[model samples]
Target: MKSLVLLFATTLLLLSGLKSQESSNISLIPQPVSVARGTGFYQLKDPLIISAPPQNDSVKFVANFLSNRLVNTKGGWVSTEFSESAGKAPIRLQLLPKEDNEIGKEGYHLSVSEENGVLITANTSTGLFYGVQTLLQLLPTAAAGHTVVEGVQWQIPAVTIKDYPRFKWRGMLMDVARHFFTKEQVKQFIDNMATFKFNMLHLHLSDDQAWRVEIKRLPRLTEVGAWRAERTGRWGEFTKPSPDEPKTYGGFYTHDDIKELVKYAAERNVTILPEIDVPGHSLAAIAAYPNLTCTPGTYQVSSGERIMVWDKGTFYALQDNNLCPINERVYSFLDTVFTEIAELFPFQYIHMGGDECYKGFWEKNKQVQAFMKKQGLKDANELQSYFVKRVEKIIQSKGKRLMGWDEILHGGLPPDATVMSWQGMKGGIEAAKQGHQVVMSPNSYAYLDLYQGDPIAEPPTYSMVRLSKAYEFDPMPPGVDSSLILGGQCNLWAERLHTMRHAEYMLWPRALAISESIWSQPAAKNWNSFISKVEHQFNRFDAASINYSRSMYDPIFKAGKDSNDSLQITLSTEIEGLDIFYSFDEMFPDQFYPKYTTPLSVPKGAANLRVVTYRNGKPVGKQIKMPVIELKKRAGIKVKETP
Candidate 1:
C-alpha cells in the first residue's frame, strides 16, 4: 500500500512537470494570428520594469496602467520606468518606424523569451494597447482581480505572437433606452469588450421606452422622455400609468457623463457611436413633444409596453411615435438632437435609426397623405425614404455619415448610408450587392438578448443563440463583395436586461465567441479550440468579479411522442465533455442512475422526470425537473395512467 501511494504521488508530480514543460497553451480569446512557443518563461517579481520610447505618452500610459493593475492584483508595488535605461527592462514597448502593410496599423508583434525578456512592437498606439491586453491575458488569470490574490505564480509564458484583427469594425451595441445602465456600468462594459479588442461601442440612446442622453436645448427629452413609470415583472406586462402614478424609474447620461465616458473609451482605443433613433422607435421623443408627430396630443412615455394594433399583415405600434416627415418642426427637432449628439460623440458615423417606422399613421393622416401626394410619393415607404434623405443631409451637416437598420432599404437605399443588417444577412447581402457599406448584426446570431441555452433552465428570452451558433456566424456572406462588409457586432437590447448583472450574464462566453468570429480570421476558426479558450476566459471573468452565465453546461432537453404514443425525451449539450443523466424517481440523478444513451421513455409509475448534467463524474449544471403532465403537454399526447 505504501509503494502504491508512492507511485501515485510520483505520477501526479510527473503530470505537473509535464504540464509546466509543455509549450504554453495560451488560450487567447480571439486567437492571435501567429504564435510560436519559446524555451523559457518571464517571471514577474518585485521591482518589475516597463520601459517605452521616450516622449511616447500612449505607451507610457499603458505601462502605468499595467503597473497599477499588477499592484492591485499581486498585492505589491511594482514601479514602471518610461525612460531608457542602461540595463534591459523586463518589459519593453517599442513603436516601429514603418508600418507592416499586411498586418495593418492595428497589428503588433509580441515576443517574450529568456534573451529579450518581454518585447511588444507595434506601428500605432491602438496596436500597442491591444498588445498590452494580450500580454495581460498571458499572465495568470488571478492578475485580473481588483484586490491582491496570494499563492499565484505571476509568470507569463515565453512566446512570440504576431497578431492583428481580421476586421476593422468589431463592435457591441448596448441599448440604454429600454433600460438604463449607469455611466460606470457603461464604462465597465467598455473595459470588458476592449480587453477582447472590440473597437466600437454603439450606444442606442433613444427608443420607445426611454431617452437616455441629455440635450440642453431639449430638456424635456429627458425630463419627460427619460423618466417613465417604474416597471416590474416581465417587460411589456407592466401596469399602465395612472393619473396619480409617478414616473420615477429611469435615468439619462448628463453631457458631463457622456464626455467622461467618451474620454475613457477613447483611451482604450474604442470609438463611441451614439444612436438617436429617429423617424421611428420615437415614442419617448413623441411623449416629450407631441407636436412632432402627425397626431398632436399629450403622449405619456411608455411604461415598457408597446401600444400595438394588428395592421395590414403586420402588427404596428399605434402611439403615433413616428415623426411626421412633412412637418418641418420635426426636422428642426431632429436637427437640434443631431447637433447635440454630433457635438458629444466623436465617432465618424451617427446611427439614424430608420428601422420599424410604423407608417400606419402616415398612411391614415390626411395632411400627411396630401403632402405625400404633393411630393408624388408612392407609399409610406417612399415618405420614409424622403425622411431618411433629409436626415442624411442633417447628419452630413454635422460632419458625420449616416447609419441605420435594414428597414431603411424599403423604399430606396440612401446614398452614402451604412446599413446595419439586424433582421438577417439578407439585408446585408442586398446592401453589399448595391455597394453600400454594411455592418452585419443579424438577429439570429448577434442578438445577445436572445436565450443562449434552454429557455426553461435559463432566463426567459425569445430565441436560442448557442455559443457554437454565434461562433459559426460569418459576417461577409458569399457572393457579396467582402470589402463592403465593415465587420459585425453583437447587440444587447436591454428590454429583458433589468440590471447590469443580467446584461453581463447574457453578454459573455457568447460575446467571447463573437469577439473571435469578428476578429479572428475565417480560416483560423476551430469550434472545439474556441470552447477551450472560452473556459479560460471564464476564470478571468471570475477574478474580475464580472457576472457571466454557465448555462452552456445545461443540457438541451427536447420532448416528443414516439409513434407508439409514448413520450420520448432527448437530451444533448453543445459543449463536448458533459454527460447527461436522468432519474424518473424524485431523487437527484447520480452515476448510479441510467446514463442517457438513447431516447428516454417515461418510466412506469414515475410521477416526474429529473435530468442533470455531469462532467468527469461530478455534477456541473442545474438539475432540470419536469412533471409527467408537462411532458405529456409538450408531446401533445394524453397518457392515461394505470393504477
Candidate 2:
C-alpha cells in the first residue's frame, strides 16, 4: 500500500512538471498587461465559426481575416457569421457602446474558456483588431504558417487578457532610398510589424543615393535620379560614376503602388509616413535638375557614399549637397514635390531631410552670402533655417506638418515642425523643452542596422547596439515633458543591406525588443522574461517563413587583464538558457569540454582558445576562435607571440 502511494505521488509530480512547462511555453511577445489563467484548456474544433456585431466593418474584417488565416494554415474552412446571435459563435468580437477611456482606443479585453469558447471585446474596431492579434498569439504556433500545418492539435490555454499599447506612435523607418524594397516585401514587412502592434511606417523615399517615388510632374526625378551605377561591397568603397557607366541598379514606386500599399496598411491600422529628404541629402534630386543645387553642373546619382575630401586638419570635409536657398526656383520645386507627396501619403507629417547640410557651399556662394546679409542671418545655420522656414510654408500649403532631423533645431526651429532626434536624447530633450513634439530615435538605442552581437560574428557595422540596450531604452527621458514626446522608432538604414533577407536578418529579435520597450510599461519589463519570450517567438517566425538572426544565442567574448597582469577571457550572452563551453589549444568545443561557469585565464604558452555555445545539450552558433596574442592585445598587454 505504501509503495502504491509513492508511485501515485511520483506520477502526480511528473504531470505537474509537464503542466508547468506547458504554461511557460505560452510566452507572448510584448506581453499583455494582465492575464488570468484558468484550470482547463479550450480545444478548438473543426468547422470553427467567427462572428461579430453587425455594421462594424472593422470587426467584420477581423473575423474574416482570422477565418481566412485559419483556412490557410489548418486546412479547414472557418465560417464567419453576422447576426444578433453571433455572441454564441465559438469566436466572437464585441464593441462596447461606451468607450473605456482608461483602456483607450487601442486597448482590448479577451477571454477564452470551455464555456464561452473565445470572446474578444473592445471599445473600438482598432481595439478589436488588437484583441484578435492577442487571440491569434494564444493559439498554437503552427497557426502562423501560410500553408496547412498537419498533425497538430489546435488548443489554447483558458485565459483572460487585457492589453493596450503604452504609447501612441510605435513606428519603424525603412530607408528605401539607399536600397529599394519591392512592394510585396514592404507588404510583408508591414504584416510582421502589425503582429507586434506597430502602427506607423516611415518610408524614406529620397536621399543622396536615389529617389524612390514617382511624381507625375517630375518625370526626370525617376527617369534620371532613380537609377544609379551598380556598386557592391562596403558602402563607402564604391568608385565614382563615370560618363560611360550605365546607371542600372535602382527602382522607384509608382502612384498606383503607393495607393495599393496605403490601402493594405490601412486594413492593418498602419499609417504610412512618407519622407522627401530635401536640401541636404538632395544629390539625387540635383542629378535630375542640376539647377536646384548651389553649384550648377552635371551631377550623377550617387551609388552609396557621400562626396568627401580631407581638410587641412585631416578631418573629412563633405562636399556641398544642399539646395540653392537663394534661388527662387528652389521653392517652386519643393512646392511641386510636397503637393504630390501630400496626395500620396495621408499621414499628417512630411519629413524634410534637414540633417548633414554642408554649409561650406552656402558660405562660399556670393549670392547666398548676399541673401544672408539681406536677411540679417548671422551664419550658415541661419541660412538653412531660412530655407527650412520657407519649406515649412510650402509643406503647410499642402495641408501637412513639416518634420525634420535634429539639425533643423540648429539656428531656429520651424514653428510647427516635429523633430526626429537621431544623434542622441539631447535634441529630443531640447525640442520637448521648447514645446515642440519630438520622436526619440537616438542612434544609440534605435539604430537597428548596427551590429547587435559580437562584431566578429555578425555583419560589419560601424557600431554596436545590443538587444538588452534597446530593451532598456525609455522614450520619455527625464526632464522632458512626456506629453510632447511622440514615442520612438527603430531605423533600418539599408546602405549595407542589399537584399530583403539581409534586412530581415538585421531587423527581427531587435525589433521585437524595441516593440516591447515602446508598448509595455517600464516596471513590467524583466530582461530574463523578455528573452524567454524571444525564444518562443522564434518558433512563430519559423512557421511564418520570416527570417531572423539567432545572434543572441551566440556567446559574447571579452578579454581583460587580471590583477596579476595576465590576460583573462570572459564569455557571456544577452540571453539565458545557454551553456557555454570552451577548449584551449584551438580545438572545437563539445559538451564534454570545460563548461564555462566563470572567467578563465589564458593558458601559459597557449596559441588560441575556442568557444562554442549550446542550448538543451545541442551545439548552437559557430565556434569562436581567438588567438592568444589577440586576446592579450585586447587586454592591453604586450603580445609575446605573433600570429
Candidate 3:
C-alpha cells in the first residue's frame, strides 16, 4: 500500500513539473510591461471560433488576419464569427468603445485561460493587431512555419500580458540603393519588422551605386541610372568597370509598385518613409543627367566600384557626384523629384539625404564660387546649408516635412527639419537642444550592417556592433528634451549583401535587441531575460525558414599584449551556459579539446587558432579559425596585406 501511494505521488510530481515549465514560458520579444503566467495550457481544438465586436474594416481585417494565418500556417480548420456566449475555444478580439488609459495608442491587454480560451482587447484596431501578434507568439514555434505544420496540438500557455511600445517611432532602414531589393522582398522585410512592433520603414531609393525608384518626370533616372555594370567583392575595393561590361545588374520600382507597397505596409501598421539622396551620393543622378552636377561631365552610374580614394585614412571623392548647389536648374530638378515623391509616399516626413556632401567639386566650380561669394556664404558648409534650406522649402511646398542626416546642422540647422543622427549621439543631442526633432541612429549603436560577432566568424565589414552594444543603447540620451527625441532604428546598408537571405541574416537577433531598447521601458530591460527570449525566437525563425544570425553565441575575440610583450587572445560570449574550447594548433577544436579558462599567450610558430563553443558536451556554435597574422592586426600590430 505504501508503494502504491509513492507511485501516485511521483506521477503527480512529473505532471506538476510539466505544468510549471509551461507556466514559465512567457518569452515574448520587446518584453511586455507586465506578464502573469498561469498553469495549464489553452489546448486548441478544431472548429476554433475567432469572435470580434462588430466594427470598421480594419478591425475586421485584424480578425480575418488571425484566422487566415492560423489556417495557412497550421493547416487547421478555423471559423470566424463570435458571440456573447464565448463558446468552446473562442478567441475574442475586442476593440474597446472607450479608451483604456493603461493601453494607449499602440498597446494591448491580452488574457488567456484554459477555461475561457483567449481574450485580446485594445482601444484601436492597431492594438488588436499587436495583441494578435503576441497571441501567435504564444503558440508553438512550428506553427509559424511557411509550409503547413501537421500533427501539432496547437496550444498556448494560459497567461495575462499587458504591453505597449515606449516610443512613438520604432523604425528600420532598408537601403535599396547600393543594391536593389525587389518590391516583394521589401514586403517580406516589412512583415518581419512588424512582428517586432517596428512602425516605420525608411526606403533609401537613390545612391551613387544605383537608383531604385522611378521618377515619372525624369525617365533617364531609371533608363540610365537604374542599371549598373556588375561588380562584386568588397564594396569600396572593387576595381572600376570597363566599357565592355554591360550595365545589367540592377532594377527599379515603378510608381504602381510604391503605391502597392505603401498599402501593404499600412495594413501591417507600418509607414513607409521614402528617401531621395541629394547633393552627395548623387553619381547615379549625375550619370543620368550630367547637367545636375557642378562639373557637368559624362559619368556612368557606379558599379559598386571604388569612387573614393583614401589618402592615409581620410577619403576624398574621385568623381563629381554632388548636385550643383548654386544652379537654378538643380532646384527645378529637385522640385520635380519632391513633387513625385510626396505624392507616392503618404508619410509626413521625407528624408532628404544630406550626408557625405563632398564640396571639392563645388569649390572648384567657378559658378559655385561666384554664387557663394555673392551670397556672402562663409564656407562650403553654408553653401550646403543653403542647398538644404531650399530643399526644405521644396519639401514644405508639397505639404511635407524635411528630414536629413545630422550633417545638415553644420553651418546652421534647418528650421523645422528633423535630424537623423548617424555619426553619433552628439548631432541628435544638439538637434534636440535646438528644439528640432531628432531620430537617434548612430552607426556605433544602430548600424545593422556592422558585424554582430567576432570578425573571423562573420562577414567582412569595417567594424563590429555586438548585440550587447545594440541593447545597451540609450535612445533618450541625457541633457536633451525627451519630447524632441523620436526614438531610434538600425540602418542596414546593403553594399555587401547581394541576396535577400544575406540581408535577413545581418538584420535579425540584433534588431530584436534594438526593438526592446526602443519599445520596452528602460528599467524593465534585463539582458539575461532578453537573451532567453531571443533563443526562443530562433525556433520561430527556423520554423519560418527565415535567415538570422547566431553570432551572439559565437566567441568574441579581443587581442592584447601580455606583460612579456607576447600576443594574447581573450575570448568571451554574449549568451550564458556555454563552454568555450579552443586550440593553438591547426586542428579543429571541440568539447573534448582544451577548455578556455584564461587568456592564452601565443606559443612559438602557432600559425592558426581554432575555437568552438559547446553546451552539455555537444557543439552548439560555429567552429572559428583565426590566423596568427590576423590576431596580430587585432592587437594593433602592423601586418602585411595578402595580395
Best of the candidates, lDDT: 3
Per-residue lDDT over 260-353 for candidate 1, one digit per residue giving the tens place of the 0 to 100 score: 9999999888999999898888888988998888887778888867576545657787578888899999999999999999999988999998
Tens-digit lDDT track of model 2 for 1-643: 9999999999999989977866775577787888788756788887788888878787788888888888888777689998766657888888877888878999999998878899888998888888878878888899888988789888888888888888898999988999989999899989888888989999999988899999989899999889999988888777788977999999999999999999999899899999988788888899898899888677888887647543553433255667889899989998999999999988889999787777887788898899899999999989889999999999999999999999899899999999999988899899899999999899999999999887767777778888888898789998878999999899999989999889989998999989998888887788999888887888998999888988887888889978887888888877778899888867788899999999899776778888888988998767877777777777889855635
Clashing pairs in 2: none
Task: List model 3 lDDT by residue over 447-524, tens digit each.
Answer: 999999887778888878989999997789998789998999889999899999999899988899999999998988
Once superposed on the true structure, which residue ranges of model 1 sit more than 4 Å away at CA? 1-21, 84-87, 309-313, 604-607, 636-643
- Score residue 7 of candidate 2 by CA lDDT: 100
**Cα-based RMSD of the predictions, in order?**
3.5, 2.5, 2.2
* Residue 296 error, candidate 1, Å: 2.9
Candidate 3 is scored at a TM of 0.96
Error of 3 at 20 (Å): 3.6
Best by TM-score: 3
lDDT of each: 0.87, 0.86, 0.89
Clash-forming residue pairs, model 1 = none
